[model samples]
Target: MTSKFDHTVYTLRRARLASQLGAQGVAIIPTAPEQQRNRDSNFLYRHDSYFYYLTGFTEPNATLIIFADGRTVLFCQPKDVEREIWDGYRLGPESAVQVLGVTNAYSNVLIDTEMPKFLENIPTLWYPFSIHKGLSVQIDNWLTVVQSKVRSGVSAPHRLNDVCSLIDEMRLIKDSHEIELMRTAGRISANAHIRAMQFCSTNIRNKNQIFEYHLDAELLYEFRRCGSEFPAYSSIVASGSNACVLHYRADKASINDGELVLIDAGCEYSSYAGDITRTFPANGRFSRAQRALYDVVLESQYAAVSSTRSGALFTDPHNAALRVLCKGLLDLGILKADKCGSVDDVIANKDYFPFYMHRTSHWLGMDVHDCGAYSEPNSLAQNSAPSPRVLRTGMVLTIEPGLYIRPSADVPVEYHNMGIRIEDDALVGDSACELLTRDVPVDPIEIENLMN
Candidate 1:
């Protein structure tokens, strides 16, 4: 079922690309392939973020081609009654062109034979080779065939380039419609997190409250009830010292009243993703040590979110958050003052990696880690870039800063066995920024009140 937003997204994306390419090339984007999960089972299909961003068509084995002159064509699966019965509904080539407002539409079955004809007069070919290797090969073979068709009197496109950069640059800014969808996605995900918190309050037993799988299942149930088909990624329900593991998915542990639980989860609404992370007391109240660490992480998160604005360097928040984190860690005695020459030297050495690892933010949209360049090197200083890419209005990103210290005899005793992460989705607006996932409480008191 196509929504009103679908057409608007398609038009905006095409317009952005056409404006950049300016009648010099053709951009081809192919949807994801259906993969076998097991013998007969297939994993739930997700569209390629780029393809969906352009056409909003969710069907598999589809390809969208946009000519440099701004003509758009869609190649998709034709309506087959038998196949539809076995699988589900299809947009069909005819309706795809009519409904999606493409210039032309054709069956996928004809692509191998007809692609050459489509490229006959085009001067440049733009396709992504990094993500879709098979599709890249198919394009290479198709280009080979097209080149073969050149009679001694005919001319063929002499330039071929990856369109990933072009499309990625265009996607950096979100349109109002895209922002609205993301807002809805963020709300649903926030509600899911709340549901998990509520579930935690009731299941205070060591086994029940801290069981990683149970918490994961509860969160997923909430997502489904709120109309999200599946989580944007594997939900992390790390509890207690388990939280100390950055990408901890082995959610098997016993909940202790003194420990903290970190939940990093999100929902996928239409292809846009809503990523959020929250850490709170497992037993509904944070202990002194836990609260101290949580406060630092929360402070860093707030500082990072506040730093987000149009025209700011993308790494500004990360650097800003790192400064705050280093001070906090130093105060907590996690990083010995004498071990590093100075705060700047400590951060430069990344000695804090023993606790805090990973960047503080990333592009968030169709993919949890959305496609877009963070930096493009400037020519002047061997490897110096244009101070990282600048944040612009319409771009949505996540501000996530965390600290983890596992219970190990080698680690500092006071900071042992603790983990805290605070993440929120924010949209860079023309003047300021908007927190799309702000509904979920991050403050200690609010989290405690909700749990109680």
Candidate 2:
């Protein structure tokens, strides 16, 4: 049942990166180190997204060294029979070259000895500073060693640059293989959201008179059943007024009658993330106030998702969704025209911060909030705003719009303590973007029917 890993894809990725770094340069990217969770137990190992992107090697204590002359050397842990009995398998050096599709592989013991020779006379050295403190010290030590050999005519690198920015740009655009993995991830995450809804609706909502952690358990069960490696982020299962607080993770509140539950959770499949959010009635049906608020948020989400195409500015989705949210709040009497002025005035002054605060979209891929620069580096005057980066084909992002109405003196009683958010994974295309997480129902009626 086991198939060989696609070694060709990783080799090609190195070739692309190598071309960017010329023959006179060298680049070193290392994977994440293991961290201890308790006294003796280590946290679950997950490879760095950037390291996994280039080498596709998941093992910790590994470093990838690539030269512009089409040479790649992977330094990793050597095989040990005694260690293997306690831990798992390791490809080692010899087997790593054959299976991992590297030009050469070596044990970690040789890194300090061999890396100095690789750095000699290389004009430009690329390293991600401010990232790994230990690696930074090691790189400085290597430069010092080469500098000490100046009497023997050995020259060290005079220029040190960051390779992380370039890799961040590269990861912004997902390839065909990455897109497929994310598509599978989105499907799995969507089904988990659906399962949470059904789990909340048992026994006419009597069996679901439980804590928010119970709902989180349902989500976890479905994610595992559908082959997801882990949740991309901590599951946010907020109920009633707790939903008004963003990034609420303490899932300990009780689900009361007429209150809605907001679950913002995602899963990682094949190392890519699938982000999704859904708000539904704790019971099978929505209350009048909940239904009205949900409709507005859903409409705003559609506006945002529609703006996710290529050639669109990165802020286009947020601007589009904000327009809809402003009008929705106005229509609901949450923001009176006389008190908050016209929609144009509210937008000009950013008067919607109280109700709809966060941005509408963000880049999505291996990490939940993936890498990439959001704006063009200030081509404007010092006091002016910079223009947003334009969206491109093959880029994946999230389109999320929400409205959170907490109790206030100005807020109407019916709209108080109600929070709603709708989110989906989007793949930018030639014209419009494709929805990857469309398996779950966004409509309240559709959710209620499925739960029933």
List the candidates' TM-scores in order. 0.94, 0.97
Q: What local distance difference test score does each model get?
A: 0.83, 0.87
lDDT of 1 by residue, 2-68 (tens): 4553486587678678666645678888999888899999999988888888887788999998876
Whole-model lDDT, candidate 2? 0.87
Best by TM-score: 2
lDDT top scorer: 2
Supply candidate 2's per-residue lDDT for 426. Answer: 94
Off by over 4 Å in 2: 1-3, 377-385
lDDT of 2 by residue, 1-452 (tens): 02367677788888888788865888999888898999999999998888889878888899998887878999999999988888888778888887878899999989898889989989888877677759988998888888989899988988888888678878888999899999999999999999888887773366535788888998899989988989999999998999999989737888776788899999999899999999999887998888988998999888888887899998998999999999888888999899888888889888788998899888999999998888754534356677788899999989999999989999899989888999999999988999999899898889899888
Query: lDDT of model 2 at residue 223?
Result: 89
